[model samples]
Target: MKKRITASLASVLALSTLVACSQAPAGGGEVKSGGEKKEAPAEKVKLSVWHNFSGDDLRAKAVRAQIEKFQKDHPDIELDAQAIPPDGYRQRVKTVAAANEMPDVFFAHAGTGIKEYFDGGLLQPITPLVNKHPEWKNNFMEGALEALSFNNEVYAVPINASVTSLFFYNKSLFEKHGVAVPKTWDELMAAIKTFKEKGVTPISLGNKAAWLAQSSILSSLADRVTGTDWFLKAAKQDGAKFTDPEFVQALTYFKGLADAGAFQQGFNSLDNTQMEQYFIQGKAAMMIDGAWALTNMAATGTKEQLDQVEVTVLPSVPGGKGDPNSLSGGAGGGLAISKKLSGKKLEAAYELIYTVSGPEGMKAVAESNSVVNYKVDVDPTKVTSLFLKAYNLTKQVKFTPVYDAYLSSQGAEAINNGLQELLLGGKPEDIAKKLQDAQAKSLGK
Candidate 1:
């Protein structure tokens, strides 16, 4: 949620293409015999699509490419694609919903946020569409479709699956410092200490935008200590609480990392892109970030540099309730159609969704070093090594949903702000209590 935002020339090109096609000849059929003219064919259906792939990166390019392909395949349909900045995207969608101006199809997350829209009767149920196309639906990974569903109705179609708790480290730096990849909490601390003593930044974190640290680090730490069951119970206000000892211990553990100077100086003032720069420039030994970073690294870093980077789940914690290999991950987000759509407009919107998140689109997503929910065939040589390593690590781990994705908006904000305070010497108990209060209020308890 507003951790960072990126805009690219590809979005501009997409908009330009949409405008250019608006001037093209209409798709209707017309015939004239003698002096009388036959009836004209139906006008092309124009569908407005809003998405957050505004950056000029591989992900954005992949989306644009898919849009072009869709237009080529269906010339009778015109897509008015608008690339919104990610930072304000959620609010923008909310504003549009308030004004009853939601587009025919729009990009949205697959969890609590989307549930809000569904509850408001603003989103279209896509279960029937999925059911009609078994071949298309079967391409998705297990539970993916279900994850995007609410109250037995599917609201969104998952495009990608993202793991946020990955520890991406510079292999060369580890070798230079004589530090092995850590396997346990103790080993991880020792590694941090070693890097610190050698005058190296152990981790690169940027929390000024807030969600970065929560999504990338604390979510995994919480799972390691209290496990996902407790958190889910707490979210539902079903006896579990954030102020429970196990949850507090998780906050304490995260504070310990900050106390040990694991993160770079002024980390809270920097943004995620800046943190990436620190890792890319070798100023920091490792970075805790989402799977999206791998795609960025593949696009910007050299082959050797990309090869030197490796990813792994957070190290095991002693006495932890969760599986040592459990990772904070889930379906990142997906496209949803408006409830008002029907007939040809609905068909065109469904086609757009399928083309972007289906087998063909997923192949492009995989080749760009990103993971997709769709089980598409991809050439191994086309995928980056970083992606392969990350993919393998995910396969070996159990997945815990990302905090913000599962929590109510207010509860999520509370944790994000509370964790930011932890970096400033806030006490674990105090932070835990604050989160508990927020969660209680969100649940109206």
Candidate 2:
């Protein structure tokens, strides 16, 4: 039940084993004094951790900063960390967990994504850890830990909030082309036409990984046509189905965008970073992406360039049952600790997790324009204008569902792969039927 996140981790910068220092070494028993067990002598220990903060971008720098601070805080502990790319990191975590060979800690998705680790006893509930730092736990936005919990026990701590469907348009380009911001389906098409005719890509997409179409665009676009109510019903296979006319119509509309050359050429072959570069270079007029992209812009683009961008949801579609001002969103994932240690070593792992994802950690990353699950107090003047715009919009807009966040992995895979085909001129009807079948099969269980 992995989420098809558009942004990928490049390398794990922090994670690994915490050699138990408080406990007797290896197989040694605790030293006894007169009539009681005396505490073991403290020794320098090595803690291993794994993460993927390979980039020097603001987000990565923020993460690295937290790690360094954690090391400094625990001078007696040496961190043995390994870096792994995003896709490889996901697979690696799975492989190790399935074999009961996980590191002391690692990064992963939440919600249904983390359920496997919890159910398999591969993870430890952090309720006690949070309890140990009540102030830190209280700083989380409402319901942030629910995504990383099972049976009311949280297993991980999420760092960011993922509002996945946003349209980031270059205001300068709109003014230069004399095109008004799109407000309806027709206006969107018209704007696309105007930009395409002007030799500019109307939208820049990086979908080589195939999850972008589902996560960034259709999640909200389809809601604009199908409404959140119908999507929930369809996902549950209760009173609605994806093959219904509304869903097919949504697919048709998504395909129309592709057919109109709304996206830059070879979008299906591009990754998000490349697409971000393409958009920042002004080769495209707009890019539909998630909230995390705010950090990318803050890290890579100049102040002037960011100031020319406006963050907002996609325009309304005609006859859409969804709120025109809504976006597809849900709680995002975070890092988890392995259930392989006890006593002081386990305590060290929990402390390390908090050091990297708690209040202080979140506040550090927020400087990079990250919209985190933790409530961070930042000077408005210090944040990038790009993030400020998106942050403000989140307050005004309702959050709709992000498909992969709720759908069964099979159902999500269906839509994700189907959209890739749909964009290449495949039949919308065919894709809708496939989606319905997958959802029905998944929910039937």
Which numbered prediction scores highest in TM-score against the true structure?
1
Per lDDT, the best of the predicted structures is 1
Instruction: Write candidate 1's Cα lDDT for 1-445 as tens digits.
Output: 2333324566777888896555444544343444234556668998999999888877778887898899899989877998998889999999989998898899888778788788888888888878877898887776676667987877777777867888899999999999999989899899999999999999999888899889989888889888888988888889799889998899889999999999988988998888887897788888999988887777668887788888888888899998778778888778998999999999998888888887788788777777776666668797887888887777667788788887888888888998889898999999888878988898899
C-alpha lDDT of all candidate models, in order: 0.84, 0.82
**Model 1: CA > 4 A from native:** 1-37
lDDT of 2 by residue, 1-445 (tens): 1333322321121111222344344446564443235556578776778887767667777887888888898988878777676667778878878788988877768656777778788888888988888888888766678778888777888867778888999989999999999989999999999999999999999999888889999999999998989998888888998889999999999999999989887889999889988887778999999987887776678877878889888999998999999878756677788887777778788888888888788887777777776667766877877787787777667778888887889989999999999999999999999988987887783
User: On a 0 to 100 scale, what is the lDDT of residue 363 in model 2?
Assistant: 83
Candidate 2 lDDT for residue 342? 78
lDDT score, candidate 1, position 139 = 76
The per-residue C-alpha lDDT of model 2 at residue 294 equals: 82
